[model samples]
Target: MTNKKMRVVTCPLTPNQLHDAQLDLPKNAKAQAKLLAYFETTEEDFVPLKQLREELGVSGQAIQKLVDNGMLQFAEKKVNRDPYAGREFERTEPLALSKEQQAANDEILLAAKEGRPETFLLHGVTGSGKTEIYLQSIAEVLQKGKEAIVLVPEISLTPQMVERFKSRFGDAVAVLHSALSHGEKYDEWRKIERKEAQVVVGARSAIFAPFENLGLIIIDEEHEATYKQEDNPRYHARDVAIWRAKRHHCPVVLGSATPSLESYARATKNVYKLLELKARINQQEMPEVHIIDMREELRSENRTEFSRTLLEKIKERLERNEQTVLLLNKRGYASFVMCRDCGYVVECPNCDISLTYHQATRKMKCHYCGHEERVPEKCPSCESEHIRYFGTGTQKVEESLAKLIPEARVIRMDVDTTRQKGAHEKLLTRFQNGEADILLGTQMIAKGLDFPNITLVGVLNADTMLFLPDFRSAERTFQLLTQVSGRAGRHVLPGEVVVQSYSPEHYSIEYAKMHDYHGFYKHEMLMRHKGAYPPFYFLTLINVSHEEERKVIQTIQDMASFLRTKLGPDSIILGPVPSTISRIKNKYRYQCMIKYKKEPTLKNELKSLLEHYQKEQAKGLTISIDVEPYVLM
Candidate 1:
């Protein structure tokens, strides 16, 4: 009657014993031999009794005869599902740590030994042995009879991270992420609740791991925007980790190459302990960066996506049998389809954005709303047959590489190419095994990639995210460039970087070229100060959406007016305007942004506003609130 137990028919005797036993054989020797042949080859310990009668053409009487002869039996067994049931990891010993890493580890261990709820901002360079410090800290935590939780930024990072942890901790590690099935997740969760798992490594949700004796929590790539849940029940894993650490009296470590402005600001203010790793392990030098201006290439009549300098570097790496990583920040075959005759473009019907043409599928897709349509032969507005695709994407770069350098092998990684389960790991494995010479990808390839042969790194278009409306665009651009640049020269071989940019003189690109995080931080802080943005003032975004534009505008206006009265006079309320890329899925969106240094009652007022719109929300109108919002659009 147990839900986890099932009745199955199993062979009680070995195949040789059954064959050797003297007995009166059935007259239908064919049926007897057929059933016996299955037992000889079947690998399963047991099969469902129903499958035996239905699939094997055997009746209950035949099975009962075997049971009576002590050859087979029906047993009820409990079902257990383990995600890593068949995988075996070789145990690894701890590597020698650098002096800076050892110093950081000592501070963390001191805090843990005293049961202090300290939050450490481990700001290390990309190749500065941050992960080794994390592992050593966890080793001490485990020795104290306490459990630990590690949160990675994305599922793409889990496979590599889990392998590292499992190789050290073995079966004591449990994985929890969206990629696992419901049953697998349940089993992992049960293992945690039952105190069977000592360490949990997974994506964001692993923060909720149920371990009563928790001692340490680690958030890798702590600055990643993916750590913030943008949807309803929104929460930042860092905040949650801090909250849980306070309850359990444990230390929480935030490890990143480029820490967020908020975290860095806090570290400067003495609110969080800061640890720095200035040099790469074993004295490996940082990659030498060269910024190539595309305008100069255009003047020279070289119109391909790759600048001459980048192309030469790629070819050099190819000839040496070293690897290369090409980052284009955008996906699809082309950014959009536009008509040369009328300046008209193909746009999605449901969203106020152009459709991206996917060369493999031969269809134009809307990145925001999942809308699709065929490419038009003639312009919709002018009825002219002069359609052309514009903008460089990963697919386009891949195509150009194949034609321009026919011998170069390229592997493309983007949302389009990595949609299937295990596709990310498979592609990365192929690249790591030296199956491909060049690794072409979008943002996912910007971090957590370590390969020894990758001596050359190229950024196809470094200005892709530099001009977004969001205030954090400059910070993000610098972080991405630095992260992708670190993929080269990580080991014994020296590394080089080629950055192709239209705005090569911009500070973000220049600082990234010099690998100067502090310079970019100081410059960006001034810009943020002038604009009254984050780390200076907190922001809350109130978004309203409706099919009717008028309704959305009116709703946002009312909310802004109501907030003006409820909040203090010092607060700045700016909005009642449409969002960038405003319309999505036929919904017209409007937002109100609230910026304040301190609004003691702001949370309560926002809750009251939601209560006032309870009826409006039920009738095709949607309202959402994001505090310390990552993306404004």
Candidate 2:
């Protein structure tokens, strides 16, 4: 207080500026100058309490209190600006709906207002404008100042769905999918949390979007197996949507042409309200389907995967200047290689499954663990030179189509071809633009695609997934066949599907051919009841894996013992058994399956069992819990 004169201080340097300034000075000079500057900035006689606080890195609150006590005058409060503050988002007006769509909207709105969850089968065949109903419901939610979330199975389908949402909802819609950059995802999540977005559309993960007031949740293609997450949390997006709806005291709309057996069961039991949209918007009829028995082809050794009927249909479509789609559920060039004389099959070293021959790479690869090897010229067993590619795949089908119809431009869309960024859209666009006269691919081409010119669809092998070990195989096969068939006949002109299968009379294939969903459901339900599969009982799978086979088996055995002790003798324990593919990625796997009635404490018991296993496991043992796993393998 000797001379309390106000001292004038120059603008304080930022940390970066100070660092740059220190680089230009000699070592000693830099140290001395920094010390002098520090003292000069902190000296009581030269600086006020507020300025001293600023120099010493004190917060605004500390300086404010000092000022309130007459110990400081003023302080500078630093404010950081958000980087994404001025970023623009696309916005568009909602589309006008037709009378049918309006009626659907009113029905959904009525249910939503009553706090009731409605399950709409949307039995409308493909191209029925079911997506429009979803949009209408979203619009109503937005109007009520609440948020909406739309869930799709695959992110590959997100781009199209996002565009549709953006076209209707504009900037109010935000998309959250794995494809988004981390920063983009964070920004989108933040936007939703801030209540800036009224609609969130994405793949499975979008179900968790932190919307302030969720009014409705839509599960598109609700029957698709991709809705189930295979990893930790093991949550089904459809199930999560229902849970979230209850949490928010709102309604959830599950829109799917092929509803899952679980949802169908719930609807039939009066647990869920069932709404059906049985007609197409444009009044276009479902495609006619024909099954070509493969037994005749095998007897004749036709060698071609495509049947004669399918070939003739493709030729007709080509002649009419219409497009075609050829589906082979298998993706490699050949499903497996075998020795004719030794009865030896080429198998994967890392997995118990056989390797498929990939023609493009000339390599045999295990689809389960991605193990690969050069395609052998001779059989390892018996030294036989009779190794041959046995079964056909998508690539082989594409090659066959090219050889048969050279004039038609053919495009193959499968995991191998569409692995790169933007490739899926590129291939689809080419097909849509008529650059590709025939599109050939695996299961991907079967879902949610609308092409007007595709008058003919061919299933190279409809029986591939029909006889899988899982009980849901028939249901899945039916859904795939029905969906692939729906891709045709979307436009004004009639369309046709040719199915090539060994089991031509199988109920799944027959029902799909007739486009009879109820008939298929009834037959499949009989099988499910006979097998004691879902809707009748709950099943949980615990998979134990390790580099050592003995360790995995032992761990699973111990787990089964513990589960039996805790869950009592009433619970069924299937195995300490090797998985279908016993080894994957060099890890030996064993599984323990638990099936029980859907009791009130079933989930809790499962959770506790998993936790107990996690704590009891020794080194080198890992366990995964899958509640209602889609595939046992």
Candidate 3:
């Protein structure tokens, strides 16, 4: 909330006020029911009745019923941008960049000054002062009286990124993300629409900020799959930004420690101007990465969750009063629960996925559909008292850490803990302020967190993503490990990383351990070339879903047949195959993949196929087409 003040009559009238006949109240039952549902929802103390009606699609009489009843009352609604709003920034200035950073900054500044529509790939190593270049380039954009848009991949990164941008630009920056309340988002959006905010910062959708003269667009962590929207419109923010930059005659800088293969290949071919930040700020050495083979650790001792080396590192960080970041990458107490005797795994009835065991609530929950059930003492299938939890998650890791090291003050951050609004900022602030000895979380904590005291980084399961059946699995594993490892030794104090993995000798893990991105890129490109994956061929995945398995199968098969005929024999058409998790929320899914080089009418043909199924869509059928999908499964 950034607005100043307004009389928002949101609170319901008191019983005494309702008794007063002077107070007009709605007599309609529908209005009363709408008012009842509105009050049931936990909302802020007050909201403008006009705004509430618009937001809820309720009639004025419906809103009046709640006010007429003892459910809502009138009060002044003050806008609050953040929980810690109105705090004074430190008036910090951008640091002098190293030679590589200066070159990158100059190139971008030149582009902005010349008002040219250029796309540059800021291919920088982690901790290479890429943000400094961003700040400097944005400064140039502002100096030219033009707006800029910065897109981050996750909301978790927004707090820190916004802090840095706001410190430099003050009130000129406005943030927009899904994490913000409706009112909060509206205020920020208005700031941009009214030309009050010169710089717009947020995750993904910030690319669509309504700025007339956008001079520069920056996509930090551009390689993130989160940049791609999974739902309708299905726009990739990077691609959108590039398109917009062209429209506005601005520069779009794609910055990432590990650029995606497609982007890097384009850079190699001189399609994108490449700029590299080769060294860390102040030339601090990269953290020493120790890839501990979990197989050897298991052979020595049956400690499946944590290896001896990682445990020792955590202990050392605790003993020295230095902060540590432990990444589990998974949430809940256990990944999944199963019966030991019958080997019957608990599964979600609505989806083709297992239920994760949450220790706090003693509930088995599905990660896909939010289906939860009480953890039974006896197995429902086998009638045996051998039901047990398996696999390590963030919660389990946290419990083990606390039990093993009683003196350590550990803060656990995961989906469960951060489900509430402002929880991410609160936890990160507590950790950043030196209130917590160790920060443990999922991928949320992997990147964009810059705490100087965090000298130790431990990755619990580095090989989990490595086994995923996708072409980019190895690339993702390497990027994740490398990004998480970059979290350590961000400042003056030297740092180290302990990565526990069963596949210790895998190319991704080994390359990550050596901090060798170039070598890994080369190796991955070789595999991609041979496999006919991205950068070599364009891939489109067509998914057909329905309640009936037969319908889903028939739909995808028919679609695949049409694609094979329409696109001709040059294109490879694969599968009406069942999706990896074929059933989700009672919907059966089958997918067809098309790998093509270049087909002039491919997009129109696909659009036509989608249109053909529009009539059947009302009969519980869904056709989703993903072009250049992040993952096929």
**Top-scoring candidate (lDDT):** 1
- Give lDDT tens digits, candidate 2, residues 262-312: 888888886777777777767788888999998998788886777788888
Query: Which one wins by lDDT: 1 or 2?
Result: 1
How do all models score by TM-score?
0.93, 0.82, 0.88
lDDT of each: 0.90, 0.78, 0.86
Model 2 root-mean-square deviation: 11.0
Where in model 3 is the C-alpha error above 4 Å? 1-84
Per-candidate Cα RMSD to the true structure, in Å, reads: 3.4, 11.0, 9.2
Task: Using lDDT as the measure, name the better of candidate 1 and candidate 3.
Answer: 1
The 10 consecutive residues of candidate 2 with the worst lDDT sum are 1-10
Question: Which is better, 2 or 3, measured by TM-score?
Answer: 3
**Which ranges of candidate 1 are over 4 A from the true structure?**
1-65, 68-70, 76-79
Summarize candidate 3's per-residue lDDT along 151-255 as a digit string, tens digits. Answer: 999989998998899899998999999998887888788878889899999999999999999999999998999999888888899889989988999999999
Residue-by-residue lDDT tens digits, candidate 1, 409-522: 899999889888678888998999999999999988888888899999999999999999899999999999999999999999999999999999999999999999899899
Say what the RMSD of model 1 is.
Answer: 3.4
Q: What is the lDDT of residue 349 in candidate 2?
A: 85
Sort by TM-score, best first: 1, 3, 2
Order by lDDT, highest first: 1, 3, 2
